[model samples]
Target: MGSGKRSDYLPEDERGASFAQIPTSFGHELRACLRCRLVKTYDQFRESGCENCPFLDMEKEHDNVVNCTTPNFNGIISVMDPARSWAARWLRIGKFIPGCYTLAVSEELPEEYQNICADNNVLYVPPKRT
Candidate 1:
């Protein structure tokens, strides 16, 4: 039920799927930030990506935005030793265990994923399912 224009429009190629379209079947340990595209996992609840997110500061509506529980990630970066992990330093994640760190796969999802989201009434994705 759109007005033939996207409010989230950002050029043609840059347009991508929203974070809600991402899968949650992976498990509770994983979470993805739609804004920063950071798909890192946690050993427990406290380690999620909610802390000090760049998007949280940018978006004023704290309630409507997604939480730390976000899942079904992409672009994994494995850190064998978090102490010596250069990626962690770059991403500004002060603490990370030895595991795969996935990047958020927001926007421009593959056609197959788009179909999946559409059929399931994906709230975050922009494409209309007709």
Candidate 2:
């Protein structure tokens, strides 16, 4: 009688492998300006959060701005600088947020990113308090 062959359920090499490697060059280690969409590497940043962006010279949009839940809110407020210029030149107005700025929170934020919020003025409202 012929003996039936037993199948190996798991791959020999994959059984102990940790995981796949993340791509190195997908991004250039650069941060893009949220307003003018300028991409600058870490070395080019003027300050911790500020950079010299081409769009910084462009106009701004001040009405109905959006922010996030931050202890400081300054980072978000700095973002509004561009929008304020946009409103003044195009809309011919001032005071972007007569109403409260819209705040949105993601599932989780990186520690550095969270620090940006912590050093700025923002009202953070979580769905549920921990």
Candidate 3:
């Protein structure tokens, strides 16, 4: 229970069922970073988000999945192709899991993907999920 003053001080907009509407579901491929190693889905893990896990920020939620059109890189340029980029680049795009953001490339790519990122200045590296 909370203190009376704290309860009363709670903003009206932040109260009641609106709080309940917030979604909190982990993905199937959810893993925890135990020590330096990445542990696969927890068999009997606690429900709430964990501060200790490195993968906490990387967890993918069901609401985030949408078809992304990714380009094919066959080591060529000057040809136009539209590869998939997540609509919500804020979510780190693909590479995580069901909603992962495993890939972290520089603003510009190296040899193979140079042309594509040249105009856009973004690169996509495939993520490795266990």
Candidate 4:
């Protein structure tokens, strides 16, 4: 078996020890990041923030967490090896940290946060509503 430390499998930039745990079950409190679609409970988001979208600074900021994350997402995907997973590539999350991600987030991020993303050189693509 592999070592217990999940950080060992993550990339250098994403080596935060806290991101090792990914939510595995659907729950009412689960929310998905508007930018990266990483799935986590409300408390988890408040505690650790989004692993892929740290610029949002969701930790302890209830407003940020509420405005940047959506509970209306669809489908859950657990990505272990983003570099080699065709599903991750197809979902455009190949460069994101390995974790449970939503297939589609069904809400829009606030314009303010969108601008923040732009200012940070991060593209904010809204989810398709088809």
Candidate 5:
């Protein structure tokens, strides 16, 4: 958190949470979580995994990161307050940690990963494509 401006938006307890850094500039390196749509750089995903979908255990797992994230996403929405932000609620990320998220992810989580979600009792809702 390091007293950064972004940490100011987070509650005191969550200021130290390990969410992805906001992309300085969008590019091919960016990827979105298939489950929560949290946006992060490919390297970031390898290093930190998805803050919202820790069950994926993507950190340091190349294949897991590849299978659980996608570069094909549209729009980025930064949510500072999940509980109160109308946009976060509309996007169905009200329970996710504060961070940059995709408006829509173009790909689906693999079937095996979907089963993992089920085993964990996490509902896996495919992103609406329109």
Candidate 6:
């Protein structure tokens, strides 16, 4: 997850097998694995289903790394209607409709987006959409 020239560090044998889900200027690479908390996207981490996941860090957390899902990320919660909004009433999503999720991930990303994807830093903190 470092010095790989970034682009959200996908290349764990191309996680999510080449992404492009059509959600705007840069809004969905969704990841939240901080030690297998599991919230993968980007075509479900390249269809290998996040193989050897070991909490891969697609970024947006900090404190170095430890199984890495960016320490249970704390930024994306974009539920639209798991049944009727209200933030999906504690979403446990099986199949989604409106997207962008990951909130109760066990806690970490608070220190200014932690490091914002340090080594492979592509820098997108609140900077995706145009």
User: Top lDDT: which candidate number?
Assistant: 5
- How does candidate 2 fare on TM-score? 0.22
What is the per-residue lDDT of model 5 for residues 1-130, given as tens digits with 9 covering 90 to 100?
4443321122335424745567656888999999889999988888877777777889867799999999988899998888799998888887677889999987889999988877666778887667
Instruction: Give lDDT: candidate 4, residue 24.
Output: 45
Q: Number of clashing residue pairs in every model?
A: 6, 10, 10, 0, 0, 4
**Model 6, which residues run further than 4 Å from truth?**
1-32, 35-66, 69-101, 109-116, 123-130
Q: Model 3: number of clashes?
A: 10
What Cα-based lDDT does every candidate model obtain?
0.39, 0.25, 0.24, 0.78, 0.79, 0.40
Q: State residue 89's C-alpha deviation in candidate 1, in Å.
A: 1.1
Alpha carbon deviation, residue 74, candidate 6 (Å): 11
Of candidate 6, the 10-residue stretch with the lowest lDDT total is 121-130
Candidate 3 residue-wise lDDT at 123: 33
lDDT of 1 by residue, 1-130 (tens): 2444422222222222122122334566566544334444433223222332322322344432344234654566655555567776575332433344454444444454345334433323432233
lDDT of 6 by residue, 1-130 (tens): 4555634333445443222232233344555543223455544443433332313343322332323443235556555444476554544432233445555565443443335344334332331222
Model 2 clash pairs are 60-82, 60-86, 61-83, 72-120, 72-121, 73-120, 73-121, 73-122, 74-120, 74-121
RMSD of each: 13.1, 23.2, 19.2, 7.3, 7.5, 12.3
* Candidate 4: tens digits of C-alpha lDDT, residues 25-85: 4679898888888898988888888877777889867789999998988899999988799
User: After TM-score superposition, what is the CA distance of residue 39 in candidate 3 from its true location, in Å?
Assistant: 15
Per-residue lDDT tens digits for candidate 2, residues 1-130, read 1133322111224223222112122244433333222233333332222222111211132110112112221111122333356532242112221211112222233344334433432212222224
Question: How do all the candidates rank in terms of TM-score, highest first?
Answer: 4, 5, 1, 6, 2, 3
lDDT of 5 at 94: 76
